[model samples]
Target: MEKDLAPKYLIHKDEKLYFAFAVIVSIIGYLFLIVSIVGFIVWLGFAILSMFLYGLMMAQIRVNGIRLSDKQFPEVFEKVRELCERMEIRVVPDIYVIESGGALNAFASRFFRKNMVVLYSDVFDLINSADDGELSFIIAHELAHIKRNHISKQLFILPAMWIPFLSEAYSRGCEYTCDRMAAYYTNNAEASMNGLTMLGIGKSLFKKVNRREYLLQSSQEKGFFPWLAEKISTHPPLPKRIDEIQMFVGDSSSSAFRRTSRAMWLVVGIVLVIFTFAGIGFLYSDEIEEAVNSIVLDANSITNDVSSDEDSTIMVQAVAEGDIAKVKEQLESGIDPDIQDADGWTPLMWAAQDNNVDLIQLFIEAGADLELQDYYEETALMKAASQDHVEAIALLIEAGADPNMASESYGWTPLMTAATSGNLEAARMLLEAGANPKSKDGDNFTAFLHAKKEGYKEIADLIKQYEDNVN
Candidate 1:
């Protein structure tokens, strides 16, 4: 019954604001493009390159991925057809399954005139194990994107992407609309919320995840930074999204809900004004700086006696400055190799960050704890991999650092760090030294998935090859 309602009815107020702002930005961008030949050429070149790249990627997926039809996954294919009818989509979009190495994600993308939905293999497996309504909800969510022409709208609004909060606001609104449509298609609010839960925690643990307790945490996400993060993000936080769905399903609203909503919009309005002024200031910065400099020319200046104190420990300074001789001298003088600084950074950790192989070796020989973690629970190995310090990573690993050791915060391994940074040599070193390529972080993302997400194609392929060989 909800599907019968006009699609425009689902569009949020923020979505309308985003579109109006985006239209203004696009007009200005077009005017600039017409006036500046170089800008037009540059934009055209980038647009062509992007289209080509996207087309190639889509072609690869179509060629290599599993296509679902009536013959294969008949029930799922039938459900897709049914949802397409309900959503009033004339063309049934093609569906493909690609290997994600355990990442839980599905996306609907457009290439030229063709619209396609990609379901990560692991997520597909999750859907297969769940009730038909779960699969229906997922498929309908993606189909809703197509039905609403979101992808094409995004293309039209491409120039507005340079505008900070406006573009992301539009994207988040689109997500909310799609979620509503998905619930409408399924007519099962519980299944709809559970689908989002599976995305957050994955299939195995989703059932055990208390929905009320999870949604309750949204009340705690307040203040400027949290509001700014959501404003700049393409998707709303999962808890907020789930709550929005609950509200849509005629759930009774609370006073806390009203307060949070008002606070979020207030932040958005304030940030919008601030960024608009900031953009204006950037355009006239030279004139503004000259005027301010002239006005402050006669301002009183205060002077203070400053002292240059060489106060840090000899060993810490040596490691920080990459002084091999000082490090050797301090080691000979019985300086503790693992002495931490103000932020809990050990000498070896500093050396690792600096990619100082000599200092790393010196600390290792002087009995530095290879497994010593910093304040963030990041080991020297993680630091080396983060900076793509191949030789330093090798030295740390050879000195008995665990390649599979995960950071306490996000369970990010040294391999995950290397893969994310596209450090091929460091990834290879970690993989050869017994780093588990399939090892997942707190979000269940493997090193391969990280590489893929970052568009590090070579590193992703290397991880895939290593994983295949291991299995």
Candidate 2:
């Protein structure tokens, strides 16, 4: 079984398809050789020429102009190298750091003879400073691409890309396979998942994001609309990728088997469609080419409506204003709710401060993980109560907000927040929902003492009731 999974540096499934395409083209050339009555040697030359051209078509990179040296960024390169070694894979690809602060990206580029991994300088900086396992997981994920021959297969799919729908399906399958490979290289699921989160889904306070809750949220998007959207996508939606990582971090073989099965079915479907169209193409090859070209040209004219950056800013504003409709629009537009602005305030944090109960509910309904804390270690519940938002407090409490949760930096809880604010209604709701009245704040004052000192007699009464209930 281990041998079966033994990494092959050669052609992968997609690469095999490329070679099939090459063979098909070569067979057609040989048939021409028979019809033209050419000399045996000339006929052989044409066949060889067809084979060479086919292979060259799959080779997307022709020159190696970029150099990847570990010496350029010794610290990051050393860490990445160590991580690759830990994964037990041979042939670690060269690492190149490029100038891209605005665009955070990492990709396997193999246009030249040498296989390479190019990481944006900002991306390296963001991830390199992370905790121990995070750096390793990220590096391991990139190496998984090299070990699995993903780049080679990607190059092989160029011909199929002419078929718009099939090309989309093939590209998506490749992403899932690479995601599985990343999980395989890092035995730690949290590390692998967190790495992806930092790349796209997480913020600075990523440590508090509940992995289970995020996975559950992703699982709810497998409906017909989601499926149709996925069919037209280049990358599997971020949540689906997270869901895929969660399913396979501990067990690569299982993940690989499941992915392979799904890929096999997709490939079978594509092959059937190709055969159905191939006969048509053979009968009227010129007309088919013209039609395919027209479709491709029209596709190129379509404008991309991706609004990740604009949507992020709008989401922050909507949260600040407690605008449920605008927030929902941004979420559906693919803006990540957990993203923070220059001040490090997530959308949830902004909504909590705005004291908008309906907007907060909208975020929760859109699958925003409520457990995620801001950079200050303040959860949404804590934020709402801190600002004396009674309705927001009630909504958060009903949604399973942990009243006892304390910020590591500030060491404050919801009860302490309500006590300091002197909001009797908020205090009563929190206490009734199991807020620990005995919990102390940064000043080491219990909720009861905080309320009394703030001259809030009604707030103090609520704290006393909670204390009395427990006693």
In model 2, what is the error at residue 425, expressed in angstroms?
99
lDDT for each residue of candidate 2 in 1-471, tens digit (9 for 90 to 100): 111243432123432332334223434544655677665567467657965775474343223223345656566667666656765653456676666646556676543334567666655666446564665565665676665555544433334454444555556656666665555555556676676676664436567777566655665655667666766776766656666665544333333212323333244344554454444444554353344445433542232122223345667877777667777777886666676654556687788888876777777777767777766777888788877788888888788888898888767888887888877777888887888888876788898998899899888876787788786
Native-referenced Cα lDDT, model 2: 0.61
Prediction 1 TM-score vs. true: 0.55
lDDT of 1 by residue, 1-471 (tens): 333556656655455555555555666788899999999999999999989998999999999999889998877888888888878886678899899998888899975455799988877885457465666778888998887667766666578776667678779878988898898777877888888988899878888898888877776777888877887899988887788888777663642243344224434443454346444544554454344344332221111001011112556777777889888876676556776665667888989999988888888888989988878888999999988899999898888999999887788899999998889999999999999988899999999999999999999999999899886
Clashing pairs in 2: 61-111
Whole-model lDDT, model 1:
0.77
Top lDDT hit: 1
How close to the true structure is residue 70 of candidate 1, measured as C-alpha lDDT?
A: 90
Candidate with maximal TM-score: 1
Runs in model 2 deviating more than 4 A are 1-70, 83-92, 222-225, 249-471
Pairs of residues clashing in candidate 1: none
